[model samples]
Target: MEKETDSSEMFIDPVCLMKVDSGNKNLMFTHQTRTYYFCAESCRKRFAGNPDKYLSNKSPKRKGLWGRYLDRLNKTTGGKSLNCH
Candidate 1:
């Protein structure tokens, strides 16, 4: 469970919630302060089209309830994290 030391090995594709080999640097992107991997370029583009939607629906480990609440605030506050996390 301790994958912090090796993110690529533990990488998970947010769009599909599928495990992805960290070595697939060609199919990944970073947003905010997180890295996301995709099985295909199409997935990447879809995510980029509406990241917040995908992010808001993300796993709790990615953004706790409080963090998500803060995210909503950002939408109304000119897209800036409240730094509440």
Candidate 2:
């Protein structure tokens, strides 16, 4: 069972910055009394795992898996460029 969505109403998914329909009942989560919509279940899970991470106004922008891996690689190499023969 799903609610009827007003096509005019849209919400931004905090985790992925994707537009979600306001009436998306399945992919919604409530935190601190506020309801949020997500583009997918994975985004919902990520938000549920750490709501504050998405809610904090001063937190660093969230990155994708490849971005995170690149950041970690940079840290491991002290920001040195990796050269392959």
All candidates: TM-score: 0.55, 0.59
The TM-score between candidate 2 and the true structure equals 0.59
Model 2's lDDT to the true fold? Answer: 0.86
What are the per-residue Cα lDDT tens digits for candidate 1 across 1-85? 5644465466667777677777677898889988888888888888888888777775566876678787888888888655676
Candidate achieving the largest lDDT: 2
lDDT of 2 by residue, 1-85 (tens): 7756665799999998888887768999999898999999999999999988877743557676678899999999999988876
lDDT at 56 for candidate 2? 79
CA lDDT, candidate 2, residue 10: 90
Off by over 4 Å in 2: 1-7, 57-85
Which regions of candidate 1 are displaced past 4 Å?
1-8, 59-85
